[model samples]
Target: MTEGLSLWSLGLAVIVVGALWIYGVNRTMMTVPPEAQKLSPDSNRWSKELMRETYERVKKNPIDIKKHLPPKLDRRYIVVGGSGLVGGDIVAHLLARGQSPEGIRIVDFAPLRRPDILGVASNVDVIKTDITSPNSVKAAFSKPWPASVAGLPLTVYHTAAVIRPGERSLQTYDRVARVNVGGTANVLAGAKEAGADIFIATSSSSVAVKPMKFWKWPLPSLASNYVQVFNEDDFDQPLKAHDEFFGNYARAKAEAERLVCAANQEGFRTGVVRPGNGIFGDVENDVTFGPTLKAGDIVSWTPHVSQNWISSRNVSIAHLQFEAALNPSVRAVPPPCAGRPLLVTDPCPPITFRDFYSTVSTLSVTPVTETYPPPVLMLILAYAIEGWANLIINFPILTKLFGWKEPTGDLAMLQPAVFTVSAYTICDDSRARKSVEEGGIGYTGVTDTLTGFCEQMAVWNARVERGEAGPLKGKGAAAPVVA
Candidate 1:
């Protein structure tokens, strides 16, 4: 009789263990909203596994941005900030990749709103929006579409900012925050309302800037310069002041970036792309480094400061890639990955700051180091940038003072951005290149920075024809190349 009882007890324990396993399975699966589970078990497993793998790869694997973006389930994409060089490049890449402009949408703070390529605007729709106000974003997304337009949700590529090297101020910082952060927040809300599946924010490497409030800090220049920007480093070394700007531009960027992360946590599948030195079409004019130029059109530069620069075209492509990787209809794509924040340098590294000056001086026909203004001038420019950034952030319309005379065109980006690349931060992209070469995605390199610079000057000259700038009152005919 005792033997029988022992066997019965063992059987009961086994039954309990099986029940617990089933219960746990159901419980975990339930966490994935019921709407999501209705998908085929195989599909569900694939998605869940992809999501898991994506996070794991991000944390442990060598950073391969391509592998993280899953294959496309739905192809429609929306590009915010498409009016800019980087944003426009993203839209064009989407077209090159075969996404019909009918499936493409572009939005910007600039005045002009036009249909994307593929003549879709002629049939579908083109939108204009103010990112800071959710209302503007929602209106843009809700534009009427015909039956010809597929109902598939979207992959949103947000690549917009109001930064220029020479433009800065507290008010400007607030303006950037409202637009960068606020506009992002509005877009996130709009995406949710429209049921867009993936979100990719064109982030900046500027988030890595660190402050140098320390006494006798070794990396003071580096530290102070970064402090003027912002850092995403999750460490306890220094506590950040949450209230306001170190200078206007950095503060707004900091807040905007923070909001973007918050948006990620709130269930919108998001990716943040931090790129440095975008050298695409018109970026050189009145944006990028244009604001840094002195009244005499001199650039605010240090010949020796090494920085990272990437093509605006590459950044645009990265957005499409993130979009292509997403699963449409679902709220989020799992495991191959979710959206991520990456530092997009270049297929190859950039020249050092010293190299940059050497080349530009040679090409622009100016003595770079010698032409570099006094130390006091650099300091003034730095302070002026901070001040102007503050004004712009607080009063968007007030950017006129920075020579940002128009609400549209290259007037928004008031300065060139200087991205500091530490030795370790620059890594090899052979794997990514291999993937692109395999034909799943595509990319190209800006081999010669000087050529890139000349290309920029040429584009700037074109903008004068665009009526964005008046007839070129002849400035330097061509940048003189040092023999």
Candidate 2:
């Protein structure tokens, strides 16, 4: 009787645990928004008829550069969000092109926070401005340029944006819209008021991508599972299609880009540059592949999904080229890229996620290739980890106890989806390359870029050791690492 009672107790405990697990996964862990379910690759919503009509109507006619001369370079530059990775790189490139540091002004909310990753001299004005407030933007722009160049034409690069504000809710969505959409409008207003001649808004390739639930679809071997490479002419997906189609970040960027292009006029030429899966250069002590390289740590992520990555350095160069072509300098030539958003990517074909991770390992002296979990299992864990991370980030004591270091306290990012979601989207930058007057973006060499990126990581790791960067609180925290 005692033996029987013990057996019954064990069975009951097992049943209770199984029931709780199912409930947790279904009710608490799943984070996929309901808007995601409305998407169907085969739906008439994505009709070919609509694509063909858009192709014919929205297609840009060939631009004749011979008829138009390049603009002059006698212009002052304003780099909004210049403290960021892309903006910092743009500042560096502008300096390398012989633009005086005094000629450029960087406006950012955290002007003094970011390190001089690109070695921008202190002479470049770092104005603290809240882009969300028009009054703030006006004040920043009101700061006069040097007396010698006071009357020069103004070229403004508005690259400031906000994303993943700790939680996925209506409030977070509103914040994103305020900064990305409303802030962009303010920048346009400020530029026009300031008599700016040229404006370029930084956008993302995600504007053209749709979120896909890959686990429910066909297996990895199916070609249909992979996203088709998007071209400039594929404007079928409207900006307001659905929030989950590309999430709030992409949606806001799409809206902002539309505004910039619409704001283009006879005197003020506005354009957008959409960079694909930008990674590999960041001055902020955020999570990246650098830590894994240092530890020779093997990680796990989704495999076989295709992704296209563009170097931040290359993106900076593209922005400068577009600005130069519009500045009317004797050295500048009329580039075919203007008045519309152009996709930027490496000339090479998209690579599988597994291959990308392996390439990083290969590039690093301490190699660390990633393993893969079955798709369904990986998705479940992704949902669970996101929930766990969100909970832990709130309680500092809990995080310290478990050994996790999130520099930014608000760590409720859709972290796991980087491997699963981003891997499936691809953007083609052929138009950007062909559109440039020089025939190419000049930074098409991926190998060289990767080598340079690895070197930068080495330097970054050294800084982390010296306590100059990374999360300040957590001394020895460990979290589940992913791509």
lDDT digits (tens) for residues 320-412 of candidate 1: 554554334442334223433444556644344344343333333222232433323333343455455455565656666555433222222
Q: In order, what lDDT does every prediction score?
A: 0.47, 0.61
Worst 10 residues of 2 by lDDT: 37-46
**Evaluated with lDDT, which candidate comes out highest?**
2
Give each model a TM-score.
Answer: 0.60, 0.70
Tens digits of lDDT, candidate 2, 283-330 = 353345545554444445444445566666667766876675555443
Off by over 4 Å in 2: 1-72, 112-119, 165-171, 215-225, 283-287, 290-298, 328-336, 359-371, 382-411, 415-420, 436-449, 457-476
Candidate 1 CA-lDDT value = 0.47
Model 1 reaches what TM-score against the true structure? 0.60
Rate residue 39 of model 1 by lDDT: 23
- What lDDT is reached at residue 468 by model 1? 49
